[model samples]
Target: MAHVKDLWWKTVKGPDGEPTQVKTARFGKGKRWLAVWHDQYGSEKSKAFKTKDPASKHANAMETDVARGEYIDPKAGDKLFGDFAKSWFNTVTVDPASEIRYESVYRLHVGPRFDKRKVKAIRPSEIQACLKELEEAFSASLAATALLVIRGVLELAEADEAIKKNPVKSKIVRQPKWQGRDVKVWSDAQISDIIGAHPAPLLPLPVIAAGCGMRQAEIFGLALEDLDFRESVIRVNRQIKKLGENYVFALPKNDKTRTVPMPANVAIVLRQHIEESPPRDYTLPWEKTDGESHTVRLLFRWPTDDQHVRARNYSETVWKPAITAAGIIPPPAADSRGRKRYETTRREGMHQLRHWYASVQLDAMVSVVALASYLGHDPKVTLSIYGHMLPSADERSRSAIDNRFEGSGLVPDGT
Candidate 1:
């Protein structure tokens, strides 16, 4: 292909104190070059060279980029990922706690890699590499989360005509070895250890989580308004996460807002917790002090929209330590940040409660569709992940050995 030299002429004053003659190219496809600059005084400017050598360098670079078929300006993408993310957050900012989790994924994983890359040029290989890199740098769970943001961004890109197709296809989306982590769940017997034990305040949530199969945030996000003592069912509709010094409430994950059957175990404690627990504006029992506490009767995401926060602070400040104190998990100080260590405890995150609840429900052989409804899971998701978690999986698998003749018993006995 033919090429032209670049002739970049920066404006300058002549020795005679007049604006110097405009520099012209001696040997190139053209003898003229143009200056592009901001007109505002002392604003900003840049020059494009129009000479054979320097200009050829530009052409050569651009040519090489075209040959590789993978070059986009660092600043001229559909939008810088970070900038787009912030705007998106503003438009859809959940509660403070949810913001923290999203920000964590943005800062720690997604933002740095794709921030400046144009959305259109984002390749499947690049996303795969990103998922792989996160897996290497962090945990499988963290890798899954990073991909979550990437997937959302690509979907936005497709919507905006930045790309023809979303790069994050189902098969290309990576799935790390999760759903089988060796987490220690509190068994039915172990549940007794923590009831009104030392620290005293930790008892109620664990009971609720393990017994009713509610998630950690659900346990904390429960407000007085959602509880129905007469119905023996606690409505779990919203939750929260902690961000720096404040709370941000948001909707439940998996779009899950459910009503769990309250057994006498969880119900009795909840009743006692309600009376002694002060009327909180949001539900979770956030620490009022190291010793005393207050109950949040309601939680607000933006005080207007619908969303919930992480329920993380309550987990750290209340749930985990309490579980440890109950002797269900190891004592605090398990995971630390170097010499400046935070307290260690077992059952570190609220997911533990979720796991225990799943295990309990599985042990009880709760029909998966019903389980999905209770846990607010999409139809197939609960069966896919926890179907194996059921102790009856072996029995089900055994039944599968020769059940091609499966028939409806409700049909005539002759049939």
Candidate 2:
């Protein structure tokens, strides 16, 4: 229950023999009303008000909220966002790769901005301003990632009832669209030139990439047993990712295992490469922090050393040089200020092959669901990325309508 009382200017003795009315400015203005109540824990709490009506209203609401178990302490939200984020991070369970990404975003982008601010004190405008700053300072994709981390932290705070609402949600703070560089595909001649320039052991890499649409990590993690020749499918189950000096085997992105149909040329190239060079055992940790190990007979290995090829080392020594030799990238330019010279390359990554594979499937009019399954992505995601590659619906519609009148004798001769 809550009650209200007035403080008069004249001193009055209480049961404890102390002055009940203390001299204050409120006494001079005749506005010394106080709402009195006990919290859920039976702790006495009071808020001074200027008049009887507002104080009584506030006291009643607080009492009702406390009784109904919906009361949130005003001081609970005073905790610093940086401290709360550390707690939230521990509560989330994620893979090693994702954990690394989260920590990096927090350290580089999120923590420094809101470390000193209380969680509840963060307003919607502040969040929007931070997002705008991030967009200006970094790529849109990176800005989106940083905002995602901040939103996650605020969501946890909201769930804990530390704040009445999360400012990072919905229209309050929107993540900028990732306006990345345009997608580039290689021509048949360009593909041939690149493959010819690469070494013999790595000859099948380009074929598998363009043919099966395997990501670089998945390509490096491919094993001989994962290929089913009879079914003509490549079973993509796992990928190798680098964490510091250790290589760990983890499930593919989204933890999805899929089988992609193998083209005839791709299968033929894989068979020839396997016959010429046998697979060797590549051992790695099953988990980054654990000592447990797993070994697989990797399809591709480094030429000089019998080990699974690392993506970075392979890209620099094999793929980059191949791009240069194939005339895809120009030779390194000489530096004028006595600095080391560097090469200028096209904006083509190994992912371009994946894009080419998507193009091939879409041009053939494959079902969106089937294509997404083949690429180990959601149907909506596949459409967002490759929907433009689908054949024009207007042309098909016109052809369908035109064919209806053909051979029906309803078509007139040229007038």
Candidate 3:
């Protein structure tokens, strides 16, 4: 049939107008079928079917589809990129923030700039130039995010026959890597000096935060019962995070509960402190009953939960003074020179204590897996980031160990 092709119904003028011609041939799977002349202009194509009934049906529809010029070519369906992306966004459901970012990129960055353009119209040089503009006009992270979204949308457009190829895939956009920070790890001397400077309200907190590496909220949320003196473990089951105005103790982040081994000194200090000032179920110092506040009630008295509205609030009021007394650094030189002196304080935030814990664990040569379980971190993350911090003698063997054999004229590889 392919060799004997171009056979169609020819319309000759006058008489009965035209004669309907049909051809027979074996198609795929070796089945014989009748072919009809569908397109006489424009596409000038034809179709085939196993029966005359379906062939006739297709002839009528093809005539209509051709008349309206709606018969799109499957091969060329993916000719445009941006126009296809909008449809892709509507069809896809993703994480709320990611979805918002994808839509924003399409509307504000990609669609308006390239919607009218074809798939092949987006050039590599042009994409790089656009990316550079994005970095300058916004932030590197935002630019990278926009680039990734554009690449995904374009690929989908190609799949949906909206574009011929994914142009944005080849575009260059560097991702930001986590750089090591020059964070102030609590040294032995600094820890000693800081611990000595504060004696009362702020005194016990440093021991919990710096010594055991408890977060300020975790330290503040400690109830007399949460401490296990016999086991020498502090149960960090609850955390005080500000959901809005007032800080409330919530189930720990990632729904985790971890017990931190405590030193005998820390335990003694806590026991003495608890005996002196007891809290109810380790509740905050700001617990309220019918709008009434009490002391010796919450270890850390914060504003009533109903009074505040913010997420992740720390006990800074008590922390600042403790930090000043500890001499880690003074609370930003109190601004007294009007608007010019209103500089923000450089006090280390809450996570410093967490970082301090990880540093100590690494310095002690604790296994990464152990630290991961202890800190409630994903094992893979702990291994990749902290595994190298304090390398064990036998846990990991570097090339330097084999260098001794090499220097002594040994070649395991038979060199």
Q: Pick the candidate with the highest TM-score.
A: 2
Off by over 4 Å in 2: 3-11, 14-36, 46-57, 132-137, 175-181, 334-347, 409-415
User: Stretches of candidate 1 above 4 Å error?
Assistant: 1-100, 118-121, 155-163, 175-177, 181-184, 196-202, 248-250, 254-256, 273-321, 325-347, 392-415
TM-score of each: 0.60, 0.86, 0.50
Residue by residue across 1-415, what tens digits does model 1's lDDT show?
Answer: 3255235344568888888646555434444442333212323233355444665555455445445654333223457556656656556545444456767887877988988877766788888888888777776677877776777766665565445577788476666544544555665555555444424344566677667777766665767777787888888876654547645444577555788888887777767765654444533323211222334554222212333333544455555555566665565453355432245443355566667777777777777788887788865767666666767656788787537435645434563
Q: Best-fitting candidate, measured by lDDT?
A: 2
**Candidate lDDT (C-alpha), each:** 0.60, 0.81, 0.58
- Candidate order by lDDT, highest to lowest? 2, 1, 3
TM-score-best of 1 and 3 = 1
What are the candidates' C-alpha RMSDs?
10.2, 3.8, 12.0
Clash statistics: count for each candidate: 43, 0, 18
Model 3: lDDT to the true structure: 0.58
> Model 3: residues >4 Å from true position, as ranges?
1-177, 281-298, 302-316, 325-327, 334-347, 383-388, 391-415
Better of 1 and 2 by TM-score: 2
Model 2: per-residue lDDT, tens digit, 226-319? 9999999999988888876678887788888899998899999999989998887777887574747878888998887777888877877788
